[model samples]
Target: MVLILSAFLSSINQVFYAKWVQDIDPFVYSFLSFSITLLFFLSLTVLKSIKVKKSNIKLNNKITGMNSIVVLNIITAIIFICFYYANKYIEPAIVSAIEIGIGPIIALVLSLIIQKSNILKFDIYVCLGILIGTLILVWASLSGKSGIASDASFTYKGLLATFTAGIGMVLATIYSKKLSQAGWSTYEILAHRFYMLVPVTIVFVLNKKASYILDVFQSNWNWIILFTFLGLIIPLYLIQVGIKYCNPLFVSVTLTLGPVFTFVFQLLDPRVKWSWISLSGIGCLCVFVIIKMFIQNVGLNKEKPKGEKLKHA
Candidate 1:
């Protein structure tokens, strides 16, 4: 249920994110987005510290997952960079489909190899199914048939960024679970994960013209808050909660539904033209994800659940 709700909210988030990027520089948007999250969690941390001081309780400064935290922050910054560039050049629906769709398969393979477990033949078929669908969607966007010219350089950058982010997204999630295993609270993980991103983005934001940044803030401050909570803050926390209780593969499968929802919501925007090719690609992607879920369900019935392993991993 947490995963499903997270997927649903994330689907809506892609549309808003795409729209915002079209209006402002992706670098600025990315900085503002992370700033909102950082500030939210920072407030929480400060309040918690105050409470602990009032009670004279000793704060536990001995961090157990510094390595995982460092890795998670790096991957997260990469994901945000890719996310902004990809959404700017590629259709948001396609970006969401490929990023959310192909990621789990790769993560599943890596997990199996790391555990030295057999790769199910069914897994191969499912991976191929999702890949084919994702490819079709990419072709639709890049074929000069989706009302956007198929400029190689223009489209290639977005595709490259999206794939990079997809891989990073999976690795980030895995490391996040590792942190949870190390006993970091969800809010702490969320708050501290931006250690690298905030400082670096602050540099970029400052490099821009002050008047332009001020104008952007004045014009879109309301949207900044709205999308910050609706898109990043809430869904991120939910995803972390889901990650804490579910395996990465299961979480990825559930998130595949995000692109399906994005396809529908994306069409409601006038900026995006209706493309039969795009719809077909997303449809195929969703069908494959369903089949993969069914296969996983059957396997789970015969043994201890994957979530149990992830919780302990």
Candidate 2:
């Protein structure tokens, strides 16, 4: 239920982000959203007086000093920038769908090269299925009323931006897993990431027109309020809380449902047309996930650990 709720919030956030781009500067936009999230999360941690008593809360020895947090922040900032730009150029549903596949693939490839992890046969099957689904989605987008096939220039730019975001997301996920293992609180990770993002955003804004920010402050604050709450506070908090209790795989599969919600919202958006190919792709992935879960459950039951009896109702 947590994962499902988080996914739904994320889908809504996408729409809010689209509207947000118009009212504020992108760099300021990034800074404010992340800052809001950081403040909200940290406040919660303080109010609750959350401790490191739980194994999950303890920082890993590997993530000890500020150095690791610094590195993680750099990687995270890049990922956020890439994602925002991708959304600027492409459909939200397409970006979300492609990102689902990229994270696992990039992690797999990186582990093979650096960690010497062997890719199993089943891994290959999973990758192929994900790729097929994403390809169908893109094809569906192209076939629909969007003139993607006709306008060569816009098509190339949009596709490039979205695909780059996918690659960026993959890198970020790989780095984040390492950070998580290193003992940094999930809150700390996001905090450090926002710290990095804010300064970089300030520099970018200053380079363009530092004075524009004053205009931003003078402008109607309602959009910022809406954007901050919807895009930053709600989705981030929900996702973090959800992941805390859920199996990582289950969380990921639930997130794959994001595209489904994105499609539903897109139907109301006059800019894009609904595509059958993408819908079919999403359906196929859902089926694949259900089968995968069943297989995993069976394997776990068959190899139950000694001294631990399976409880029956």
Candidate 3:
């Protein structure tokens, strides 16, 4: 039940994140959102701070304590900028689909290259499914009543941007995993991730020649707070928590549903027609995921050793 709610909220989060990225500097926003959320979470720590069970502390205090976070900050700033721009030029649903759709494939390839994973038959099938689904989605998008030329017009640019963002995100995930394996607590990582963004955002916001930080104070704070809470704090925490419990690749696969959920919400919003091609592609991808999960679980069950049977003995 918790997982179900988490997944549902995670989907809605992609929508709110799309909206939030519009007005906020992605770097600063990422920073501020985490900073704010950290404070909120930290406040809970004050009331009920459970001591993190101490594990072997391999964290390189000199090299990783502050320095590593600093590097991640810079990398995340760049990622957010790319994401913001991509969302600006393309529909959020489509962009989300393309970015997350390719995550498992890219992650698998990178894992193999980095010696973090072994190539498997099912991985290939998953990759093929993702590719086919993506192509079908693109084709459907092009065939819309809006016309093929219109769909194809920004397709390449939009896809490239989203794809690049996905790569960045994958790299970030790998790095985070490495850091976590080295003994960084989730809070500590989140703190470092957000803390680094502070300065980056300041520079970006200044360079934009937009209103200064003080300008934000003059605007309505309600919606801003709402967006920050719903879009950033809540969802980010959920994702971080979710990844803690499940395979990262599976998390990426679950996120693919973001586009489907977004499309459903949008249809109710503006009365858009669903295209058969896209619907079928989504169905195929989902069916493939379910089948894969069932097979993997069955394999796991088969691998378990049976206890001695007293009656037979």
Tens-digit lDDT track for model 3 on 83-195?
66666545555666667677777777776677555445665687678767766665655555211223355656666777787776666666666566666656556655755
Best by TM-score: 1
Per-residue alpha-carbon lDDT of candidate 2 for residues 1-313, written as tens digits (9 for 90 to 100): 5655666777777755754564556777776667666677667656544553545335446436456567757766776776676666566777677766454555556656776654455554655676777777677556543311235455456666666766665555445555666665566556555668777766777765656665675584566667677756676656555545543334454566777777676666555556666677766665655554555446534333477653110
Candidate 1 error regions (>4 Å): 49-62, 147-150, 294-313
Q: Ranking by TM-score, best first?
A: 1, 2, 3
Q: Tens digits of per-residue lDDT for model 1 on 174-267? A: 8888887766668878988998887777777787897887788789999888888988899999999989988777677778878888888887
Q: Report lDDT (Cα) of residue 61, candidate 1.
A: 28
TM-score of each: 0.88, 0.75, 0.74
Model 1 vs. true fold: TM: 0.88
Q: Where does the lowest 10-residue lDDT sum fall in candidate 2?
A: 144-153
Candidate 1 overall lDDT versus native: 0.78
TM-score of 3: 0.74
Candidate 3 structure lDDT: 0.58
